[model samples]
Target: MKDNAKISSAVIKRLPRYRRYLSDLQKKNVDRISSNELSNLIGYTASQIRQDLNNFGGFGQQGYGYNIQSLYNEISSILGLDKDYKMVIVGTGNLGQAIANYTHYYKSGFMVSAMFDVNPKLIGLRINDIEVLDYERLEEFMQDNSVDIGIVCTNKDSAQEVVDKLCAGGVRGIWNFAPTDLQLPEGVALENVHLSDSLHSLAYYINRNSQMKDQD
Candidate 1:
């Protein structure tokens, strides 16, 4: 077993990509994979893969390569996906509803166990078979359901308040969609997804490609 806290954040970030690629290889009946093969498949250098694996102790054979199932299990356990994570969504707006309905999230190890909203009309509504409970009942719901993660899709102004309530209610992880900076307490993990930043970057790439074509 490895200490997840001790692992570099960069390595931790790449674990999900590695897991997905390995899963694809398994589906293709790949029994063994070399670091070079993984590197090519994932677009990472061979040496980087070896170094990442070395951090968790070498699992690959000297010449034979790594067993697909063994490597998958090792990575899965390291990333804490071996066990299912129960999550709740805070906010029942368009983005929140879409996230609740996203089938791919369920295919992974995360489960959207519940949803919360401040709107009285939206409360008690069902989205994708998950009941939308009142945000006022967040503490009770969290205690009753033992939610491990929270998806914050509230407006920028209320996002911090919602996070504060979530923290007080015992959430360890938060997937935030608000475009505001959040001040999180210690031991709580906050992952922000900035839609505006992504769109801006996409526009930059489009312009860059156009300039490249003009040069050609």
Candidate 2:
């Protein structure tokens, strides 16, 4: 792999999509693929694919293209999907429960070890066999368990506080579903999944396409 710091975020973001397509190809028993062939399937230009991949040591050969399974495995390793991550979810609300269920079904290395919530009704409730513990016990749980990631499903008001506690407790990363942005101390990674922003972007494209159709 090349120097990670020098790689553009755009290239990094495209890695997962590349891996997904490669996975699909592998399921179909594809042994290798040329850049042009992969670009047709993934919608990226062949040159773009080659350039983006070149940032990560150029997995493709000049004429042999790329080994399908090898590239898939390499990209997965690059994205850190090869390792296991034990996570704790803060806030056992509807979204939190949905995430817990989704993670339970996902056959990946990510596992939700525990969940926390402030609601009395939700506390002690089990989702996918993972019990929701009281928020007050979060600190104690953190001290006792080795958590690799923290999932913030709380409201904007409580998100930062939950993140602070998670960071203090030594979680290496945070997957924030909160509507607001959060600050993190150096060395702790953060990935924000703002559903509203995505919905708004969808709305924009929908309206834009409708207007274009009307113009015709």
Candidate 3:
């Protein structure tokens, strides 16, 4: 096992991308891949890919490059994707619902164990076969369940508060969907996803292309 303290978070994040590409290569029966090939597929420079991979240890040879199967197993184990992770989601809104309906999580080694909300009407309802529990029961539920991660889909105004509660409830990792930047205490891992920002960027690109066509 690699020392968690020694590995940089940036390298940890890139491990997933590496795993996905390696998995794709595995499906195609690709026996080996060079760092340059990985760089081209993932949009990183060849030197950058080599540096990231070398940080963990030299997995590739000087001329033969990396064995696809060996690299896939290595990255998967490093990222903790070799084992199943228990996860829960807070908030039962549209975004939360969409996530609940997503089947890809199971395929990726994460299982959504529970869903939560403060709404009386939503509590006890089922989303993707997981019962929607009242937020008041969060702490108790965490005690009974082996939840390793929490996903926060609450609004921006309530995001920080929800995160605080989750932390207090013993959640060490969080996937925050709310727009607000959260201040977390030490030993907690928080990943923020800004959907609106991605949409805005997409819109900007489309508008820029349209304007260029109009000029031409």
Local distance difference test values of all predictions, in order:
0.87, 0.95, 0.86
**Cα lDDT for residue 179, candidate 3:** 88
Ranking by lDDT: 2, 1, 3
lDDT of 3 by residue, 1-216 (tens): 346688788888888888889889999999998988888899989898888888777899999989999989888777777898788899988889888788434467788888999989999999767899999888888878777788999989998988887887788799999988998889988888999998999999999999999999
Candidate 1, residues 131-199: lDDT per residue as tens digits?
899898888886776778889999999999989878887889989998988999999998989999999
Task: Give the deviation of candidate 2 from the true structure as CA RMSD.
Answer: 0.9
Q: Taking the candidates one at a time, how many backbone clashes does each contain?
A: 0, 0, 0
Best by lDDT: 2
Ten contiguous residues minimizing lDDT sum, candidate 3: 100-109
Q: What is the lDDT of residue 80 in candidate 1?
A: 85
Output the better candidate (1/2) by lDDT: 2
- Residue 168 of model 2 has an lDDT of 99
The prediction achieving the highest TM-score against the true structure is 2
